[model samples]
Every structure is written in structure tokens, then in C-alpha cells.
Target: MKSLGSSCSSRAAAETPEASRERRAGRGALWSAWPRCAPRDLAFCMAALLLFCLGSLFIQLNGGPPKVLLELRNYLGESTYLDDHGPPAPKVLPFPSQVIYNRVGKCGSRTVVLLLRILAERHQFNLVSSDIHNKTRLTKHEQVELMRNISTIPQPFLYTRHVHFLNFTRFRIEQPVYINIIRDPINRFLSNYFFRRFGDWRGEQNHLIRTPRMKDDERYLDINVCILENYPECSNPRLFYIVPYFCGQHPQCREPGVWALERAKQNVLENFLLVGILEELEDVLLLLERLLPHYFSDVLTIYKSPAFWKVGNLTGTVKKSMPTLEALQVLYRRMKYEYEFYNFVRDQFHLVKKKIGLKSLLPISSHEPSFLRELTLHTPDPLEEEEEEVEEVEDDAKNWLVQP
Candidate 1:
């Protein structure tokens, strides 16, 4: 009986070691088959990460954020006019915005207005054309009329017109986002002079002086002669109708001097959100579209070919013979104020673009938060608070303007 008990104890002890080894082997195999993440989930995660990075990059590049924001707000993976259930978390989307476009004539206002109209249609945002019908742009008269009543505009609109900035300055919202385009002052005057004769709005103005002494196609009004003779409209286009439209609506803006020049520059920096030059319209539009895909994405479609530019290219203006140095000098003198303002506008536009960190960029997704801030994190301050802040900015700008 003693020998039998000792043999059973040795057999049980030996089996215990084998049982432990089998259990360890089974646990190792189960862990080896288990995945850190399913393939679909892993793919989704990678895609989400990629989008968030891209969205962040876009906002960072556009220095004049308003120019690109309203248009791109839809894609920032937040709640937009198109989707209340914007992309999933981590996507930082901006709130709905109001934009005002002070569309100065012959400064690519048509293209800008058209782009806004298309954006309005696609995004279902309210676009206020005011005077002009949906099909055509506003005439000069209509633009002026719109300016008189610009103050009555409701909040949250993308209002456009070929009017001066002053007209809308008092009428805008706190933290207002104003945008305008400017052309070379001299060139703009010349273009308008000729365009009036050959393009459309000919013989309708008080200044037009068509004499029997000119050739048939040379719709040279006496006003053109007066303009060449060192007059603005015939000598001061600002007093009549002109560029530097970003200057406020005050009677002084149309008067020639450093005051209007400084005011225009200040407005561009402090008030206007974006100021684009006519020569660089295409590239700027491209930049705008990339920065604000929602509003300007379709802008490039109409301007697909350079041919769109040709329709009005050098029309009614002398094409072959360049203006002589003497003529150019005389013209420059007449438009010195305009030229100065134009130069300032051009410089300011580039400066703002640089400030906004303009660059070649690609749009990204906003579904992931690790790559960017939740856009919804941004809540604009109360309207009163926002106004106070803007007032501070304006005060600072005024001080700078007054400095010697």
C-alpha cells in the first residue's frame, strides 16, 4: 500500500508540468492572432489624420483669412450650410460669416461678383446684389444708387458693388470683413475712357465730348483730350468716377491729396479683409479658391482659359503704339494721386498675402482632431465686444495714419 501511494504522487507531479506548458502555449497563440486594429478601422484612422493636417494647413496659409474662410468653412469638417452633421470630431470648422465686397469698377469687379453669385447659389448663402438683377452686373448708376442705401443691408450677406468703401464703412458689422480689388490708376482711367466709347456706356455722360474731328473708331471724346491735357475725369476722375474705390464715401475721398491716400491705405490694412490687384487676378483667384474652396471653387471654371481676359483686353485703348515717355509723364502727373494709391494698394495686397503665409497648398480632411484644433472651438466674441476691439484697431490705424 505504501509503494502504491509513492508511485501515484510522482506521476501527478510529472503531469502538472506538462499541463502548465500546454496552457502557456494556447495563450501565446491567441494573442498572436489578435490584431491591434481591424484593417478597416486602421484605414479610416489614417485617412482621418491626413484630412485634419490638410485643413489646418489651409487656414494657416491664408493670412487674410476672411477671403478664404467663408468659402472653405463648409470643408473645415464643421457644421456648414451644406451639412449640419459636418465631418466627425477633430475637424475645426468656422461659424457662418458675413462678407462685404466693395466692387470698384474696371477692377475685376465683374469676375468677383460672378464668383460670389455662384458661391451663393451652390452654398445657399444669401448674396445681396441690391441694384443689379441676377443676370447682369450693376451699371454705374445702379452702383451709386446701391451705395446710398447700403446701410439698410441686413446682417449675414455677401454684398457686392462698384462703389466706394466709405459708403459701407459705417454700415458694416463689427469685425467687418471688407474686400476690394484695385487696378493701376492710370490704366484704369484709360481703359474706362476707351471702354465707354467702344464697349457700351458711351455718350451717356456729361463729360463726353465727341467732336466731328475724330476718326470713326476713335471714339475719342473731348473728355479724352481733356484727360490727356492733364485733367482727371477730363482731369480729376476721382471727382467723377474712378479707382481707389476703397477710399471712404466721404466727399474728401474723391479729392486729390495725401489724406485720401493715407485713408485708403489704412482701410486696406485695418478694415478691408482682402485687397487684390487686377493684374494678378487669376493667381489670386487660385489662391482664394484653394484657401476658401466653398465660395471660390467655381471661380476658376469661368476663367478656365485666358480667353476670358481677351474679350476686354486693350479694347478701345491703343494697342500697338505705346504711350510716349512724355505722354506717360504727363499722364502720371494727372493721375499722381491715383497712381500713389494704386501702388499702395498693390503693395498692401502683397504684404497681406505674405502676412497670411500664402503658398501652394492642397486641401485636407478635418475628420481627425489630432492633426488640428476642433474648428468649433472658435466662437466669435459678442457683437459689442467685437465692435470695441475693432474700434481699438481703427484707433491704432488712425494714429499711424496721422504720424509724419
Candidate 2:
């Protein structure tokens, strides 16, 4: 009976150790699951709420995406007057990839073409040659053929030619920007005349070497005779050149009249991105550097510095002597429209310089252009004078009504 009782006690002790191990194993699973499930879900919900709040604030401030881009104002510290809505539109624009240069004759356009070639060489843009090589206002079919070739010439190409301005859409150019230079009409016509006569009358042809079989000017033996004739084909045909070039190559614009003058001015304002004057080539260089940095990044430096401007005054093409006073008078009379167009362009350039506050173009010590400086010596435009008179009268009337 004693032996049997001792054996039962040992069996009960062995069973107690196995029951304790099972209780510890169940507690380990609950501890691991608490970290992986409930806390993670709580963190995710808080992040989502914070993102929603930030997105809502942005939408309220900017109105909407389309307007936000259009209204983006470059603040040099919160710019000019704005209504309760917001600020005015911007002026600083991104760079352009393609460009069209409508090269007017004897306007120092060759210099600009040289700059484009330099840009193409450095920046890897294509400087394409047009199929129609003639400078005279091309016939309609010739214009179409040249434009057709240009439209499909591929990206990053700069088209430089003595072509006149026409509607870009008619030629299928995508987002084209036009640029040109104009000279004093008298100077422009003279350059072309002597250039044909003496093949660079400056006695230096090294600047632009003549190719074999170059055509000589036999239009007239004497400069005076050329000017005296005032023929459309001969004697400095200024009427056929300046205004018609800007007014498009159409026949209507070719006729010397007010219609051509007005049309040319309108097209320049609407189509041309920039227009430069030949007399102020330095200003042109500075303006180009500032406005079209991507294309003319180092024009002044790489293209022979300030001295280059003086060398190309007449582009190695001024005659040893000039025409007689009477002949010149005849030339200017025929080219009255050219003179008006020249003055208009020069005035517009000055206005741009003033508005932009261009510091690099000219020095403070520099004087105004002779023409503008001596405005009192010349007759004012009748149209502008009438406008001034009307404003004066309106002011006097207002003063009379307000008198106490």
C-alpha cells in the first residue's frame, strides 16, 4: 500500500511542468500582433488627413491651374497696381527654338546673318539655306516654293534671307518670330548702288571676298545720273524697297503711297519680334544680347567687339563720292514714304529703350539723336500736332467748368 502511494505523487509532479509551458506560448502571440496591426492603421489615417488639408489650401490660393500659369507675375517685390483680384501679366519669356530673319537689303542684315551662323556653330542649330536665292520681292509661286521647303526643314533651324515679311500661317511656319533691321533710306539705297558699281567701294574687298563671275553695276556711269533718272529700275529705287519689304511682297504694297506706309507699320508691330536701326548698331547688339540671349549670347564679344560696329558703317560699300544735291533731292522726294517709315522705326526703338530702362545700350553722357534733338528745326507731323491741340482745348474747358 505504501509503494503505490509514492508512485502516484511522482506522476502528478510531471503533469504540472507541461501545463505551465502551454500558458507562456499563448502570451507570446498576442504581444507580436499588437505592434503589427492596430498602431500601423492609426498612423496611416493621420497622414491622409494632413495631405488633404494642404491640397485644399493650394487650390484656394491659386484659383485654378490655367489662370495660375497665365497670371504668373515676376515680382521684383510685388509689382505695380493690381485690383482686388491679383497682379498684372508678365514680360519675361522663355527662350525660342526657331527663328525667321526677314533680311532687308543694304540694312546691314549680313552682319546679323553672321551672328546667326556663329550661334548655329556653337549651339548646334541648323542654319538652313533657302531654295530661292533672289532678294527682289519674289513672284507668288517662287515665294510658295521657298516657304514649302522651309516648313519641312526640321527643328532648331534659323532661316536667314533677304525675303520680305508675309503671313506666317500662309507658309505653315509653327510659332515663327520675325526680326529685321532698317537703315536711313538714303544711306540704304546708296550702299546698294556703289556696291554694284565698285564691288565694295571702300577699296577693301577682303571683308567679303568676291566669288568668280560677280555682276558689275552698269545701270548708270554717274551717281548723279542714276539719281536724276529716278527710274523704278535705276537711280536708287527707295520707293520699291523699304515699305514694300515690310508690307509684304504683294504688288499693292509695292506702289509708293500712304497705303504701303500704313500697312508696313502695322505688319511690323504685329509680326516682327524685333526691329533694329542701322545707325545705332551698338544699341541693336545690346538689345539683342538682353532680349534673345539664347540665340545671340556672345554677339558683341565673339563678333569683333565695339569696333566692329564702326567698320561696317556702310559695310565696305560706300562710293568715293556721292550724288549732286539736286539729284539727292529728287531721290528723297521719290522716297518720302521711306523717310517716314525710318522715323517711325527710330521713334519706336527709343520708346522701347525708355520703357525697359536699358542700361547697357548707351551711356548717360550720350546725347539724343540729331534728328530728335533738333525737333524744333523740323516741321511736326500735322496729325500729332492736331492731337496736341485737341488735348489742350479739352483741358481749358475743364478748367473753366471747375472755376470757383
Q: Could you tell me which residue pairs clash in candidate 2?
A: none
Best by lDDT: 2
Query: By summed lDDT, which 10 consecutive residues of candidate 1 come out lowest?
Result: 366-375
User: If scored against the real structure, what TM-score would every candidate get?
Assistant: 0.51, 0.59
Give the alpha-carbon lDDT of every model.
Answer: 0.57, 0.66
What's the number of clashes in each of the models?
Answer: 19, 0
Candidate 1: RMSD to truth: 23.8
lDDT of 2 by residue, 29-146 (tens): 7887775558779889889999978877887786854454445643233444675457766644335656787778778776777667777788666687454436757777877776
Evaluated at residue 307, the lDDT of candidate 2 is 63
